[model samples]
Target chain A: MLSIKNIVKQYAQHRALDGVSLEVEKGSIFGLLGPNGAGKTSLIRIINQITAPDQGEVYFNGEKLNPDHISKIGYLPEERGLYKKMTIGEQALYLAQLKGLSRSEAIKRIKYWFEKMDMQTWWDKKVEDLSKGMQQKVQFVATVLHEPELIILDEPFSGFDPVNAEIVTQEILELNRKGTTIIFSTHRMESVEQLCDSIALINRSHKILDGKVKDIKNSYRDNTFHLNYSGAFPAEKAGLFSIVKPADSENVTVKIAAGKTPNDLLSYLLPSIQILELKEQVPSINDIFIQKVTQLS
Target chain B: MNKILLIIQREYLSRVKKKSFLVMTFLVPALIIGMYGLIAFLTVKGGDKKAQVKVIDESGIFAGNFKNNSSVNYITTKESLDAAKKEATESGEGFVLYIPANIESDGKIELFSTKKAGLSAVSNMEKQINDLLRNKQLKDAGIDPATLKEIDPDVNIDSIELSEEGEKDSSAGAAYAIGFAAAILIYISLFIYGAQVMRGVIEEKTSRIVEVVISSVKPFQLMMGKIIGVGLVGLTQFILWIVLSTTLTGAAGKLLLKDKIDQVKTEVSVNEAGKTIEQVNAEGPAAKILNAIQTLNLPYILGCFLVFFLGGYLIYSALFAAIGAAVDNETETQQFMFPITMPLLFTYIMSFSFIVNNPDSTLSFWLSIIPFTSPIAMMVRLPFGVPAWEVALSMVLLIAGFLFTTWLAARIYRVGILMYGKKVSFKELAKWLTYKE
Candidate 1:
């Protein structure tokens, strides 16, 4: 388990992180979502021990984070960094050793990862000679080759084509399945919907929303319903709820007013048309994200 | 400790494996040997050729003044002076020595060549004329020529120095050569390798690789690893160069001298005569230099040279590493590097004075003890002698200086490695020095 509690980071006249906190359970993919400059990087740096927080503490596996703890955490920073002059295999092995793996162990792990990623032929090539996507693959291998207890990937899928993105997505899931807790940070809500078990959303240095992926969506529910019927609903139904859009066919989506229940909405719609289906449509995480961010803005 | 060792091993292997290192290691020594060989060849070839000149004496007093030589064909001309000058010009070979009538009384002689006569040739001709005049004076005094020749005497003086151990020392020329060689080695190594450390740091910082590496290792470890690794590379190259150049120069020297045995014998005799002449000719300059080198303790000089070289390099390299970490680019590095490198330049310039005034004075002791100036200053004093206690004290202080500078540099490195785009100034660096974290 990785726990970051009440971490506050201030840089002179500006407050970068304002008492932000989040938890990532073991063997789960946790999404940390925020708009640009939302203190996501600051929080990541603190967790990675790149910089110490002004006032905060992070615990990993019941012990306070320290230099010793850094060996057990694999971090892929948002801004990609690799020594351009170093060969791929050499760099991978070097980074693995720095993460506390012995030489033979590092080589073995590097070979295994290279074979798995089908990057065996690229082992002897310089990083500068490799394309951006290929470099990202090498970086991914380096990040997970040590088999750390916790993995933090920031914008891991950026600059990747769809094919390569899918490749990384599969690898990320495989690592998570192998019992590595992952903190995945990105603005891609679709990936969160696909992979994240829970998430925290920060806007303007404040976490406005966080919970289980399903629960957060459910919590932001406004009793919106999607109705499909044979005939038109009553004109009075428009007065009972805020009509989002009325379809040209006999289908419409409506937001029920405050203090109004779905039962009331259904009762009002049932008598006005031959209803084929009247389902309460739960909003997607994307909808919830935009709605929450726009409301704060 | 293990990580530091690992870093050192990687640095060493990676650099040594480079083509640039391999080329320099082999090429530099070859170049030095080739240069020396070229010099020896040119000297031998030039000495084999002799300049030929013809002489003509006009005045009866200067008759028989010319010396006969196979190379220089002396011709006696009874024609008028204008005819002799025309003959000399037509011959296109040698100059005409025109001695005016009663030249001994006038004390004036002239030489006319198509081109200007060389100084050595003109002096030789003048000496022959003076000898003839002296002989004429002897004949006029009614002295026998054979007796006058028998009474002429030439004296030669041989120089020798006794070492403290009662051994005859070699020529002071050899000692000066050794001293110069040691000084140049120290000078080149300190600047070249120290700049290498600085440039390495700047490359890492500019590329932002320091960010990732520093996350795992302490700044002190990184700095030490770089300095030690580069130092080892330098030592390796130096050893290789010494071995290669020694072998090549020895081989070339033998091959060039192999067929010139008779010439070598003659040259050796001439060299001995020349050394004797130099000792008697130049007053006491050669003897003073011989005494200076022979009286000094050789072992102490070498030991102090090694200590000061290592100490000064470490101190300067530490400051370079700090400067590397402080700035983001090479342009910014210049602002700091000038101040750091000034001491080295200053020490090299001031070294000569320290060698002359007092090799064991308080000033020399202090300069050699201080790590910044020790590399050059201590070396200058070593050619002269220094006390054992002074050498030991200087070593202790230099080591201390290296440690303190390393610690200070590591402090700046810790913060500077992470800072970016925030142009760090001297004031800011001063503040960073006080920063506890």
Candidate 2:
């Protein structure tokens, strides 16, 4: 678990994070959603202790974040990097050791991860010899090899193909299921929607939205219904509900009037129109993200 | 501490294992020995090339007067001077020496050749002619040539240096050579190893692995680790070079110059009559050099060298590391490098031009004491012998300077490594210095 309280970070002539705060619950896939240059990286860096916050405190598992907690946190930066001249296994072992693992322990975990990722043959291959996606896989293995209690992955899926992305997604889910807290920072709203139990959407220098995905979606919802019907839309009863889209070629979209219910509208329409399909439209996290960002800016 | 050690180990091993490191380690000593071999060959054998002289002695008094040595051969001809000149030109083989019948009064001689004779060849011919005329004059004056030889003054000035211990034979030339060599080694190693640290920093930054590495260890730890690591590599190479060069050159010396060394012994004994037995018994130029080196107190000088070597490397490499972190790539490093490397470059030039010549001057004293220039400047003075307190003070200041620069560099490095795609100015770097950890 991680808690960032009133985190304020500033670079020269620019405010990177302005009083942004968030809580990452234990054993949850916490999505940190933000646009480019949205202070997400600044916040993540503060949490990782790569840089200190000018005016805030970060607590990891109820203790103030200190150097000792470094071993308990794994960070995979967006620009996935490995020493090009070093072999995959050598670099991985080095990284694992830097995380406070013993040499034998690091090797054991590295072997396990390399096998899990199907990278056994790549142990001796130099990083430059590997494809970008392959390097990403190696970086991924390195990130989780120490089995940190909390993992911070910045744009973890950027260089991955769909297949690898799915694999990484499954790995993240599996890690979470095994009681590991993950802080996944990305702009990929679909993954956030798919994997995140909770998220904090940051825009510019502020956290614009924070909550469970379903609740946030429900909070933005209106009583709008999408109808697929091949029938005459009764012109006189149109005043009962405002038509968001007119009945054109077997589809009608409308928002029900405040005093009416969906059953009442259906009853009123049953005589004139035979509905093929009627369903309430729930906004995807992608739409809500776009709408919220556009509104805030 | 453990993490820093780990980082140092990784940095050191990664570089030391490189093929370039191995190649340079073995190849440089071979190349240096090869170069010295060429010089020795040229001095011993190239100088022995025979030059044939065609002599047309018109003076009957000078018949069969010229003598031949290893470097020059004289052949008397009965042909006329113009005919000998023509023959020499046509043959294109050697000079034509002509002595006129009025040689006893005018004491003049001439040489004609198709090509210009070497200065040594001309001088050798002059000496032979001068000696022949002198002997003839002495005989005419009724003085014996043996008496003239006995009266010849061959005064040898034995330069014995007086020090606190006692009078010891000293060669200023040898001291100059050793001091200059040590200073140059420090100067070159500082640049070579310091630049390597800078390039390593830039590699980690450009590769974006610095972030990953720093997250586990402090920036200060990482920077110190890299500087120490590269410096170890430099030290290892230096030690290996010393060992290899000495061994190889020693073997080559025995193989190529066995006769040359014996010749030096005989040459030394020939003119060393009035000197002490110690001077004559020193045997040869090689043994004298060995004595000079021994008198220089090599262990003390080497101790100072090791301290300043690491100290200088630590100081300069900290700056280089900071510069590397401040820039995005190697090309961008130039703008930042000039100010940092100025002290090093200035001291290197001054070590050769000023310090070596005036090791005891007030300027040399200050140059050797200041931390920035001391590493090289002190080396220039070390062979001449520096006071103990001055060396101690310089070393302490160097350590202080190293700590200060490393602290300054660490501040910039932590912030700079994460920054990308921005043209970093001096002002920007100053701002980074003010940034929080």
Candidate 3:
């Protein structure tokens, strides 16, 4: 488990991160969602020990984070830095050793990762010679080669194409399944919907929403329904439920008032029209994300 | 400690394994040796070319002054001055030395050449005429030339030095060689390793690799690893260069001296005897130099030279590391490096003067003891023996200076490694120096 509590970071006149906090459960994929400059990088830097927060305490596996703790945390900063002149294998081994693996151990791990990623041929190639996607593959291998307890990837999927992104996504899932907690930050909400079990959303340096993905979506749900009926229903006859859009002659999307139940909405609409099919619409994570962020602003 | 060693090992291996480092290491010595050989070859080839001379002795006073050598075919002419000048220019005999009547009174001889007379040929002809005039003056005075020469016995004096520890001193050449070796070692090490640090820092910063490395290791560890690793690489190259150069120089020396080996040995012994005689009759600048050379303590000089060389290199290398971290580019480094390098340059320029005036004075003592200036200044002072305590104290101070400077540099490095965009200034560097974390 990774816990970040009340992290506040101030930079001169600006508060980069203000009272931001979140928890990533064991064997879970946690999404750290925020728009550009919404304190995600500041929080990530603090977690990586690149900088210290003005007021915060981070706990990993029930212990306070320290230099020793850093060895168990794999961090891939969003800027995507690597030594351009160094060969792929050399860089991987160097970073692996820095993360507390011995030389032999690091080499073994790097070989395994290389083979797993089908990048064995790239061992002798310099990073600069590799394409942007290939370099990211090298960096990704370096990050997870040591098998840290937690992996924090800031926009890990940015440079990757869809095929490569799927490959990484599968790897992240496999790692998480094998008991590594992953905290991935990105603006790609679809990835969050696909991979994240829970998410923490920060808007303007504050955590405006956080919880299990299902629970957050459930909490933001307003009783709404979509009906596909052959007969037309008068908008006034729909009672307190307002028709957001009338699709074709056979379909209509409707929103009910706050206190109205699904039965109450059905009771009013059934009398005015022949209901062919009526289904409750559960909001998608993307819709909920956009709504939450916009609401906070 | 293991982690530091790991960092050092990684740095050392990575840099040493580089093709550029290997190329430079071998290339520098080869270039230096090639330059020296080229110069020697050119000198020898230039010296072998011969010139012809035509002499015009108008007074009949210096008629026999000309000598016939294979290189210089000297011809005598008693024709009219205008005719001789015209013949000299037209014939293409290199030059005509016009010796006028009463040349000794005139005190100057005129040489006319088609283009220009070779300087060696002109000087040789002048010396021969001057010797003839001197002999003529001696004969005119009613004194036998041989008798005058016999009476003027060359005075010789033997040099003997008593050491403070009751030991007889050896030749002064050893002292000079030791000082020379020490200064060269210090200069080469500082230059090679300092640039290594600069390049290493620039490489990391330019590639943006420092962002990842900084997350795992503090910038201090990284900087120290680079400095130590590069220093070791420099030492390795130095050792290799010394061995290669020594072997090459010895082989070349043998080849060059092969034909004249026996003649050179006999000539050297005769020269030594002549030097003793000259020392006895010594007057003017030569005698002062001989005295200074005699007073030098060769052993102590050599010892101090080694110590100061190591000390000074470490001190300057630390500063270089700091500069490497502070600047983002090599061009910007020049602005700061000049001030840092000035002390070493000043010490080298003023070295001989310092040795002459007062080798044991307060100025020499302080300059030689300070870490920044010590390598050159101490080597300069070493020839005129410093006290044992002063050497020990200087070593201690130099070590302390290295340690303190390294610590200060590491502090700046920790912050500077990750800093980008804003151009770093002295004022900003001062602020970083005071930053506690």
Candidate 4:
């Protein structure tokens, strides 16, 4: 678990982060969401201790964060970089060792990851010689090579191809499954819904939203149902439910009126129409994200 | 500390492993040796260039007195001056000397030739005519010409350097060469290794690698690692050059001059007494040169060299790293570099022109004591033998200089490494200096 309290970071002319606070539960995929220049990177950098905050305290599992905690954390910056002239294996080992791994351990873990990622042939190839996506794979493997308790990846999938992105996603899921806390900032709402368990949305140096992913979606949901019917469906007015035009021609979307349950609507419409499908429409994370961001903006 | 060592290892290994480093290391010493060999070759061959002179002395008293030597072949002619000039122009290989009948009263003479001769040739003719005239004057005055030759004295001042220990023969030539070489060596190494440290820093920042690396190590550690790493590379090349040049100078010395020297010794040995006197004059300076070199406290000099070498690299590289971090690319670095390099360039010129010539002067003394110019100026003073206290003071100031600049540079580097896209000015850099880590 990680807790950031009252973090304030000021640049020359702008305050990159202002009085921001968030808590990430242990072993959860925490999505850090923000628009451009919203202090997400500043918060991430503060967490990684790349830059110290002007005034704040970061506690890891109830202990104040210090240099010792560096071993417990791994950070992969969004704009990935490696020594262009160095071999892939050497570069990986160097990064792993910098995170406090022993030489032999770094080498072993690097080899295993390279093999798993189908990069065994790239061990001696310089970073400049590799494709951008291949380099991204190497960067990803290096990020997790030390097996830290918390992994912070900033836009890890930005330069990755679709297949490579899926690979990264699966690896992140596996790492989280094995009790690793992950913090990734992304604009990809689809990925947030698919992978994140909890999220904190930061906007303009302020924490505007924070909760469980399912709870946030559930809270944003209304009493709406997507109804599809066949044979003898009434086009006329209904008493219990209001019919809304479906964006598509074949399906009809309807909202249940107040003080009405799904059973009331089902009973009201079952006699006249053969219902092919009936499902409650829960808001996706994308819809909740856009709606909240729009409201806040 | 371990991480710093790792960074150093990476920097040092990456550079030392390059083929360019290997080639440059050996090539520099070889080129220097070849240059020295060429100089020695020219000096010996230049002395032996054969020349001929046809003398038409109408004065008749000096016709047979001008002797013939292997280097300068003389032929006394009876033809008129006009006919001799014609012959000289047709020949186009040598000069025709004209000594008129009134040459004894008027000390004027002329050389007529189609081809231009060097000043040494003209001076030789003057010496011959002057000696003949002088002997004739002594004979006419009823004085012994042999007694006058015996009375003439050649003044050779035996230069002795006085120290607390005692008097020792001094060779100005040796002192100048050694001092100039030391100063130049420091200047070159400072520029080379210092720039390397800056380029390394710029590479990390421009490529955005600093953020990832600094996540685990402090910015100070990274900077020190790079400075020390490149310093080691410079030291390695220098040591190799020293060893290689020593060996080549000895081998090439013999290889370049053995046959020519033998031929000159044999041919010029016919005038045994005159040639032996010339050798005595040359031998005195040569022996004094060896004595001067022997008086140099080499271990002491080497110790001071090592200290100032690292000290100079550290001081300059600290600023270089800061500049690299502040700017986005190499071109942006030019404006910032001028201030840092100004004093270095000034010290270099001062070492060559003023410091070595007058090491005991007040200006040279102050230049040696100042930390910024001390590396070159002090080394230049070292061969001339600096006082113990001044040497120690300069070293202490250099250590202080290293500490202060590194502290200042670190403050700037910590903030500048993370900055991008902005054109940073000196004002911005001054502001960055106050930023906390």
Candidate 5:
């Protein structure tokens, strides 16, 4: 669990982050969404303690952040790398030790993770010898090697292939299930729809929307309906309700007016058409995302 | 603190295991030994070429006086000047020396050869002819040649160094050699190791691993770890070089100069028994060198060398590491590197003249007190016996200098490591220094 309050960072003439705030809950997957140059990285860097904010306070588990919290927070920067000349096992051990793990404990955990990822053969191989996707996995292992309380992944899935991406997704889910708080920034709204429990959308140095995914979708719902009929055509007034899809004998989708109730609409159309099915349409998170971003921009 | 150690361990192991490190550590001493061996080999096998000199001697005062040594042969004959010159060119064997009839007054002669004669050959011929002409002149003046030879003296001034404790019969030449070598060694190691620290920083920045590293460790810790680790690498190489060179030199000396060294040892022992009654030259040259080495406070020089070497390295390497962190590539490093290199270059050149010629000069005293040049200047003066207070003051200032630069460097490194994809000017760096930790 982590909280950042009123973070402002200034770089030369550029205000990288202007008065942004965020909170990451325990045992939940939090998606941080923003467009390019939206100060997502500046916010993340403040949390990771890479660079201090001009005016802000970061709290870890309800205490002021300090150097002791470094071991508790794991950061995988977007532009991350390993020492190319150092072997995988050695570099991992060195990094793990830097995170406060004892040498023996580091080696044991590294071996387990390497075996689990099917990367045991790369233990003695130098990082430069690996392909981009393979190196990403190693970096991932390094990020989570200490089993940190909170893991911050910046663009974790960019360089990975689809298969590797699936694998990483599963690993993230697994970590969340094990009670590790996760905060990841990405542009893939589809993935966020599939995986995120909560999200904070930042745009143009402002937090426009943030809440539980299902609740936010509920809030952005449009008055729409899907209908399934058995026998006849509904001789409804063309101006009353807009037919959303091409007419079908067994099914139809429609958008009704805001003032009308579903029961009132059903009663009004029951005599003309044999009514069988009626369902309200709820927008997808992607639709809400696009709608909200366009509205704010 | 423990993280710093881990970082240091990683840096040291990663570099010390490289193939370049091992190759250079061994290769340098081998090359040095090879060069020294070549010089010794050439000296032992002196020139064996035989040179012939034909004299025309129109003066008629000297005949059969210019003789032959092992390498040069003198041929005196009563031949015409034209015949001698023609024979000299066609024969292709030697030179034709023409001593004019006015030689006893003029003190000048001409020699003709196909190629320019060797310096040693010409000087030998001149010595032989001049000796004979000088005696002839003395006899004509009615002054006995034997008495004139008795009065001719070779100057041998005994150089005694005056010290606060007492006078010491110290060898000025030996002191200069030791002082010069120590000063040069300090300068070379500082540059070598300091550059290594900069290169290591540049490597980390380019590789982008520093981002992840600083998340777990402080930037100050990272910089200090790297500088200290690389310094250890340089120290390791230096110690190995000393050990290897000593072994190599000893083995080579035994193999090539066994008979010569043993002969000198026996003669050295005989001179040692009569040292108090005899002048410095009465001892063999080798014996004098051995005795001078014994009189030197070698342990003191060595101890001070270790102190100043590390102090100087720490002070300069902080600047180098800062420069490395400020720039993205080696090309961008040039602008900042000039200011750092100027002082080092100044001291290296000064070691040959200012520091060596007068350790007590005003400029030398100031140079030895300023932290930038003091490491070399102080070492140069230390062998000649610096006052204890001056050495102590230099030590204090050097430590302060290292701490100051290290603190400044860490400030730059803390901000600069994360900055990428931009040309960082000096103004940007100056702004970074004002940033808060």
Candidate 6:
């Protein structure tokens, strides 16, 4: 669990984070969604204590975020890398130890993770010998090797192939299932939709929206429905509810007019057209994100 | 603290384990010995071959006056100048030395050769002719030639250094050599290892691993760890080089100069057999050098060297680290590097040309006291025996300078490491210092 309050980060004349506040519930997958340069990285850096907020405080697990909290949190920056000349096993062990693990413990965990990632033979290979995607996998393994209470990953799937990305996604879910909190900042909205229990969308330097994913989606719902019917569509009797789609199509979408429920549109269309499938079209987070960002601009 | 140690260990081990480190450690001493051997060989071999000089003493007073040494041989001829010139030219083996009948008044002599003669050879011939003429003039003036020789006695100055412990022999030349060598070593090491620190920082930044590193520890800690780590590597290599070079050069001396060593040993033994003062003085130079080396306070010099070397390295390497962080790559480093290294370069050159000779001058005193130039300037002064308080003051100032520069560098490094693709100017770097963490 983490709580960030009124975090303001400034860089010379540019403001990286402007009074951004958000709470992440315990054991929840929190998606920090933002466009490029939308201050997501600045906020993430603040949470990880890589840099301090100009005028704010962060609480981790009911305690003030201090250096001791560094051991309890793991961070994978968007621009991640490994020492190209160092062996994978040595590099991983060093990184794990830096996160406050003992040397032997680091080695043991690295061995386990390397085996799990099917990188058993890569222990002695230098990072330069690995492909970019392979290096990303090694970086990912290093990120979670110490088993921190909170894991912050920025664009974690950028260099991973589809299969490896799926594996990593499963791993993230598995880690979360075991009671680890996850905060991922990414531009991948579909992954955010798939994995995040709650989401915070930041625009410019401020948080525009945040809450349970379902609640945010529900709030953005415009009461639109997609109807697939066999009978002739009623074009004239649709005054109470406006048809969002063109009138000639067999499968059409409609929006209920103000002060009217879905039942009103159903009753109006029943006599003329027998509705086979009536599904309320909930706005995807992608659509809501674009709409919200465009509206702010 | 543990994380810092980890970072240091990685930085140190990664470099120390490289093949280049091993090669440099061994190869440097060998190259140095080889270069010295080459010089020694050229001097001895070239000195062994004597030049043949055909002296045509038409005045007949200079016959049998010239002596043959290792580098020149004299062959007197009685023929006319043309005949001597024709014989010498036909043989093409030596030069023709002509003495005119009125040589005493004119004090002029001529030597004809196929090529320009060596200055020492020509001067040797002139000295022989002059000595014969001078003796003849003395005899003409009713004075004994032997008495004239006795009047012109050889003089040698033995410099006795007065110290608190009493008077002892000191070789100013030896002291100068040691001081100059130490200053040169410090200068070279600063560039080699300071640049190593800079390159290490650039490697981390370009690889984008610094962010991941600083997330676990502070940026200042990372910079310090890297600087100290690279410094330890330098010290290790230096210590190994000292041991290995001493051993290697000792073996090489025995192997290459065996005959010379035996000759010196026989000369020393002959002196032990009741030789005259002249013979003893003939062997005094070698013994004087050994005595000078023994009298040098080596432990004290080495101790001061280690302290100043570490202090100077810390200061310069921190600035080098800042330069590394400010730039995107090695080529970009040129702009920032010049200003930082100017004082060091200026002091290093001055230490060789000016400070060593004038170790007690006001310029030397100030240069050795100021932290920016003290490392090299103080080293050049150390062999001449610096006062305790001056050294202490210089050391204290150096430590303060180290801390101050490290603080300045950390400020620049923390912000610069994170900035990507931005052409950071001095103004921009200054602005970064004002940025909130």
Native-referenced TM-scores of chain A, all candidate models: 0.92, 0.96, 0.93, 0.93, 0.90, 0.97
Off by over 4 Å in 6: A236-239, B43-48, B54-56, B75-102, B105-116, B153-159, B264-293
Cα lDDT tens digits for candidate 3, B199-270: 888778767677677677777777877787777777677677777776886787566645444543554466
Local error of candidate 2 at residue B124 (angstroms): 2.8
Which lDDT tens digits does candidate 5 get at residues B1-437? 88888878887888899999999988988998897788667644542456778888888887787656534678888998789889877887688888888886765799889988888778778777767878888898898988986897857766666787687767666677788888889888888888889988888899888988888988899999999998888788889998999899888877877765565456557655443222244334656666666677788888888889999999999999999899898889989989888988898888786778887889889899999989988888876778899999999999999999998889888888887877888898889898865
- Residue B324: error of model 3 in Å? 4.2
Error of 6 at A249 (Å): 3.1
The TM-score obtained for chain B of candidate 6 when compared with the true chain B: 0.88
How well does each candidate superpose onto the true structure, as a TM-score? 0.83, 0.92, 0.84, 0.91, 0.87, 0.93
Model 6 agreement with the true structure over A1-297: per-residue lDDT tens digits? 799999898877778889999999999999999888999998888877888999888999889999999989989999888898999999999999899999999999998998898999999999889999999999999999989999999999998899999999999999999999999898899999999999999999999999999999999888888999887887734558777887555688888877888898888778887788999999999999999999999
List model 4 lDDT by residue over A1-297, tens digit each.
Answer: 999999999987888888888899999999999888999988888888878899988999899989899889888988568887789899899888888999998999998998898999999999789888998898889889999999998998888889999998999999999999999899998899899999998888888889999898788767889888876556534556777654344477888887888899888778987788999999887777677788988
List candidate 4 segments past 4 Å from native: A229-259, A268-276, B43-48, B67-71, B75-92, B106-108, B112-114, B141-146, B149-153, B258-272, B276-291
Between candidates 4 and 6, the one scoring higher on TM-score is 6
Q: Which is the leading candidate under lDDT?
A: 6
lDDT (Cα, 0-100) at B144 in candidate 3: 81
Clashing pairs in 2: none
- Candidate 2 per-residue C-alpha lDDT over B147-219 given as tens digits, one digit per residue, 9 for 90 to 100: 9989988777667777788887777777888888888898888889999999999999989898888878888
Query: What is the per-residue lDDT of model 4 for residues B1-437, given as tens digits with 9 covering 90 to 100?
Result: 89999999999999999999999988999899989888877867766676778888888889778865435667898888888888777877787888888887875688888878777567667777777788898899998898987888967777688898798767677878777878888898888888888888889987777888887888888988998889888888888888999888988888887886686567566566655333445436666777778877678888888899889889999999999999888889999999989999999998888887788999999998888999989988887777899999999999999999999999998888888889988899898877756
Candidate 3 wrong stretches, greater than 4 Å: A8-15, A53-55, A203-205, A226-230, A236-240, A243-253, A274-297, B35-96, B104-108, B142-192, B266-364, B434-436
The DockQ figures for the candidates are 0.35, 0.76, 0.47, 0.60, 0.70, 0.81
Superposition error at A205 for model 1 (Å): 5.9
The local lDDT score (0 to 100) that residue A161 gets in candidate 3 is: 95
Q: Ranking by lDDT, best first?
A: 6, 2, 4, 5, 1, 3
Q: Name model 2 segments beyond 4 Å from true.
A: A235-240, B43-49, B52-70, B73-96, B112-116, B131-159, B263-291
Index of the highest-DockQ prediction: 6
Off by over 4 Å in 5: A10-15, A225-255, A259-263, A266-281, A290-294, B47-116, B261-296, B353-355, B381-385
TM-score of 5: 0.87
> Lowest summed-lDDT stretch of 10 residues in model 6 chain A?
A234-243
